[model samples]
Target: MGDVLRRRRPSRAVAPLRRDPRASGRFQRSHRRLDLRQGCVGRRAALLRWALAEMQRAFLGVDCGTQSTKVVLRDPATAAVIAVGRAPHELIERDDGTREQDPAWWIDALRGAVRDAVRGERFDIGGIGVAGQQHGLVCLDRGDRPVRAAKLWNDTTTARECADLTRKLGGDRRVLELTGNLLLPGYTAPKIAWLASHEPEAYARTVRMCLPHDYLNLWLTGEFLTEAGDASGTAYFDVRARRWCEAVLAAIDATRDWTRALPRLAPPLSVVGMLRREAAESLGLEAGIPVSAGGGDNMCAAIGCDLVVEGPAAVSLGTSGTVFAYRAEPAVDPLGEAAAFCDSTGGWLPLAATLNCTSATEWVRELFAMDHAEVDAAMASGGAAGLAFLPYLSGERTPNRPEAAGVFVGVRPSHGRDAIVRAVVEGVTFGLAYALDALRRAGVAPTEVTLIGGGSASDAWAQLCADVFDLPVARPAIVEAAASGAARQAQWAVEQTRPSLAPVTSRRFEPRPRRDLREAADRMAALREMAGANRL
Candidate 1:
């Protein structure tokens, strides 16, 4: 019994490090006993020197989303990400069709992300910038303290207010003409109207209304400001003029008691302010570190995906789907087919955002009891699902129709989960194509679309984008393109100079022949037409 628990001891044992100066260090002592390890210390010291040089020029980028906040530390010279960290936060859904989160929760999550990113040691951390969820309204009092939880973009409580705005603003035509978008519940105007009518006290206390990214920027730098892309989402920004819309503000006054709610416009790449002392300490960063007023999540992602050039767009299939086409100048459709948002690159970008993309696929997958990989393979098989899906699991944004519900037409008993899943994927892709067609109708066709997001990770899905969009779709190896875009903004803020946009390394997926894609897309168009007619 004693032998069973006893451990065997070697004839000689070597301890690790010795602090005594008289005694040789562990490596040296061990080396003297073994001659082959002599030069390793010098080599390690040289590598450490190189590493420090690389770290000195690194920039920090943070992306705040609905579910989590991601912090990325990148090396500017090589454009390589050195450190990545994420902090998860909670999302609360009220029974009243309202979705919101404590503004403090986002702040705390951001702090934790930064702290975790720079833990254990000091980092140069040249600059810091944020790319956060857009269209979410955060009200702040005169003291710059949050008055209440942030009303997220998905919140449907503002639906009635949004409808009122469309009517008061002279229908969708006036909204598109002034704000470069159709009236939507996700915009700041509707949210403000809802608060003014329902939460009058809170609305009266509000001194300034800011987007999510702006709120984080305020905490980091004590500055109240917003980036161009985010400002564009507020339904009060003049895309061509690059300023706040005075007309929209006045229009709201007639319908809602929003006398105090207004947002100031700032360029997406504008330098907001330096990091505050408390923020600096928490992030393990030096005080006064440059913090750029980064743009909305999608716009920053466009920058991250390197979609600065005209023609080529970036397609993000996140919780929501978006096809963002970079333009050298402002582009607005009178028909309200697409939105003209301010790009982080200091220009205008026309965007078409679908309320749901991957979220739609996930719903169908769960409903059918099929895993992602299995469904993805079937979709890539190029077999027709004999079905068409509208992919409106939530609702619609671009094209400005929310009543458009998800549809699974042409379903038959022979079809299985694979066919249904393929239809969902194809349906979302077709929705994207519909937006692309709008871009083309406006006389601006994308040369290519850079696919970035969770959907792009799957080869089958990437091929599907290529097939459905009928153009080359590029994907990047970098997972956090949005965070990288923020890092790029930070790098520009601190460098005392701006760098020219250069194409970064990325993989391309050229369109391949697909007979089924055309058929599926045509079916989707017909279904969309029927749905549109039903709404009318």
Candidate 2:
């Protein structure tokens, strides 16, 4: 079978779920010339025209992902994406766990993306919502330009700083009490501390600090502001209070004037400001377009998955996997097992973020020198590895300490690369399931799962998730849910007063019987526990 056919041999339910005549015709017409593989979404007419007329007239959503920046023109009335555009981005790094990016490059990429998206279009793009890789700190000079490269979420250069912050803030208990999370090198506070102590001059010049998405919002509207969703990731914000905690700031003895450098907080859906004429001209957009206060990638992904209202949580497996459970009230973990934050939709989300996921799979594939063809072949051969692996190569993030790295135990020479590959896949799935368990413990038992991210492209991976999680995953008809999500946010932002602008379809995944699921779960639990014990 060809890759597409083999992968898309839809489940039995898919046949019955095929669109009725009217919807199918509309889809075909709206998406007439676009190919799915090349990121052709939002090209359909009813969807497109509705968006342009009602949504795109006022809002634009831009997502600055790890690999690309996607821009969408949306219609607020229908909450559809009229047009979409993307630009590439690269991650810089070193062996010492340093990953960074230039803030200027991010801006240029976004500008280029917006220009491409609206090149021939005539809609008046208004409120812009920017979403980007979370946990990255963008420090700025007094004039609001970057003083140095941003320290990304994946960068581990602040490990020592994380430890120092944990110690200074009265250990894990106190850290969780105040920040809703313990010190991790990936969060904002440790990065700030790392800069303050190591590069005082850069820190001194840093009049304000912003997360990656917030920084882009500043450039778009020339306003200093951020939403609660992004703010909670910074160790400085109090999850319970939903604002910056002065006590935490006092504990770190950060410069008394430091907080003033940051933008005033904006509600997630709040309209921050309109585009400046210069920004508009650079991006081929109209001046005075409204820009909504957007959110972190995870929050936006949840919105894309329709997890904003309620019901089963969504699982996003990109390079990293995040299991987000939404709640109307904040849920804190004093034990620091999960990271809880504010959702962009004025709710709380209990997040289980383990570094292991699609990244581990990619790393293992590369380590074995196996290309996409090899991985596909192995899966087609019913590849099953009796072996179990711990995919914490970059350290575990959720339900385990960030310092915990990946391990493949019980590797026998008899174990082939295929077995290793299967083990890696199962490992990440089980890790995510572990997070779901955490959510259940917190009294939010999800009834369904919305599977998303680039990793969702793989049939084998989705099947594995369904089997391991023992729950059907909702694979939406369209991919690029993040970009679509940003576009939807644009729709909502422009309307301002509308209720429930998101469109929904009845699509779902059902669990396939897997005899080995229970065994695999048991083994993964033992491995995680053993790893935890060794750390102490």
Best by lDDT: 1
lDDT of 1 by residue, 40-150 (tens): 665564555555655445688999998789998888877778788778889888656677988888776776676566654446767787998888989988888889999
> Highest TM-score, which number?
1
**Candidate 2: stretches off by over 4 Å:** 1-58, 367-377, 380-383, 501-507
lDDT of each: 0.76, 0.74
Off by over 4 Å in 1: 1-55, 94-96, 254-264, 368-371, 500-506
